[model samples]
Target: MIKRAIALAAVLAALLTAFAVPAQAASGRYFYGVHAGLAGVRDYHGYVPSTYRPGTPMPLLVALHGCTENSFGFDLLTGFSALAEERGFIVVFPDQSTLANPAQCWNWPLPTNQHRGLGEPSLIAGITQKVRSQYTVDSARIYATGISAGAVMSGILGVTYPDVFAAVAMGAGCEYQCDILAQRDPDEQGRAGWREMGSRARSVPVLVFQGSADPVVPPATAGRVIEQWAQTDDLALDGADDGDIDAVAESVVRGSVPGGRTYTHSVYSGPGQGSVLELYMIDGAGHSYPGGCSCSLYGDPSGPDASGITWDFFLAHPRR
Candidate 1:
């Protein structure tokens, strides 16, 4: 068992390579439509920035909206449209249907929907692949990020479809488990459902954002996500027996975002010092995307911009 674990870790570690982040968005065309998938249909709206050239491949970022929120509403709430227009990347917003959930939420908190090639994960992955095949996209530079329930779905994408995303950023989200958001399993294996879903992307990089004062989804919920990824990074690097960050952590960076949140940034190095897990604990913010607009529907505008922060993180990590 130990030998097999060591061999698998080495092979996965070798898969990480330096990636070049693209600049400038396309001026070609923007479209909104519905995609038919095995699970169901998903509505998506995308923007091709003005900075884009005709033939150059651009990075793709899939931004998911929270419950009761539509794609256009989330674009306003997070100012992602404005960022994409300036930063030069393709941004896709996938909307959840009321039929899936009465609140229009991604069914990520359910065990049935948590695995790969099934439920909402399959639908979203199909959309990502469709976008990649349609436009000039950097296949290795694809990424995902979301707020609240959307944030939870982003975690699911990172775990279940790492092959589709380079990395995932989650804000005020919980782990990829069934009912754990409202109920705790309390078992080691049960709590680590993230590891069980898929091992192909077991050590895929993760960026977490949690509001210290979030009212809707507290930092405790985000803590579970950070802890899960941190432990998975440990098991991948040195096996389950030595899964402890305090001892294996390569470095810890701590500071504040001007006058807003005093944040702690922890990085766990995988096989080649490739940073695999990161946590940003935002101080004094509500259940909204940090550094976002005063849109009120999704996040607090007085803080640092989550869009800019996420783009920077995604730029540094890519699937090999």
Candidate 2:
């Protein structure tokens, strides 16, 4: 059993190493969509690993872009496609509807937008379903991740569609605050809707990555989200600790979300998840992708390699 476990770990590590880090020469595809008879199309880019086969059920990762960026920007900045090529997974980068928000931001905080039947979350869920129908996807292994506003959307998805996504890696996002805001009586229906959606996220495993120095989303917001998720999962709370830091200088901290049968928390470095929830706190970073690389915008050269870390966390847990 020991030798078998060692071999499994080695295989999983190698798979993650090949697909989690950034690389060059990643391919992209554009998927056209027309929703509810709307005469418009959204662009989604798919990145498949070099070793992908037609019949194999590969995992899928959906990468969402931040405000002011499109699907293409997400592809250029995160370099996840390179990792997809190595890991033998399918990665889909969905473009936000410019018509909905001029800045292309996901309406994560709004209650109506968080629902499943209609709105952006539904659109995304539709996209995922469509992709699965067209490809050999391991439905149980589907995951999501994003930057800034995109991170918030990821949270919404985890909460709204707990069955669709196994885990989520949210970078620089926050919890659903509509309930608190609605206490002021802004919109009673909206508040109720938000709470309803929040209730749906009880089973999803989330790995949150936030930079302490991010100006867009305060680092404290990340902590609050971790706590919120912990409560939602009905897990006993454990204390927090610092995880690993990278050569670029970014650091991570983690706390446990107690499941009745298992204990799960974010780890800076270790084997993948056997527990329920994990949170990754990126220290001294900004609202950008990490690693020792340079880019035009939103790429921190002095931070830890986040792409690799995000993938590691995603691989550790499947949807439960």
Whole-model lDDT values for every prediction: 0.72, 0.63
Point out where model 1 deviates above 4 Å: 1-29, 178-199, 236-241, 244-254
The worst-scoring run of ten residues by lDDT in candidate 1 lies at 16-25
RMSD (CA, Å), each prediction: 12.7, 13.7
My TM-score estimates for the predictions, one after another, are 0.82, 0.72
Model 2 misses residue 303 by how many Å?
1.5
Candidate 1 similarity to native, TM-score: 0.82
Cα lDDT of model 1 by residue, 1-320, tens digit: 99999899556433311010122223334567688978899888777787767579899999998988766667767766667778788888888987888898888867767778888988888888888778889888999999888988998887678667888999888866634544653234223644554455345678888888888875677656766666654554444535543223466777777666666666766666477777777778778778765644566766667788888889888876
Query: How does model 1 fare in lDDT?
Result: 0.72
Which candidate tops lDDT? 1
Off by over 4 Å in 2: 1-23, 26-41, 178-202, 235-273
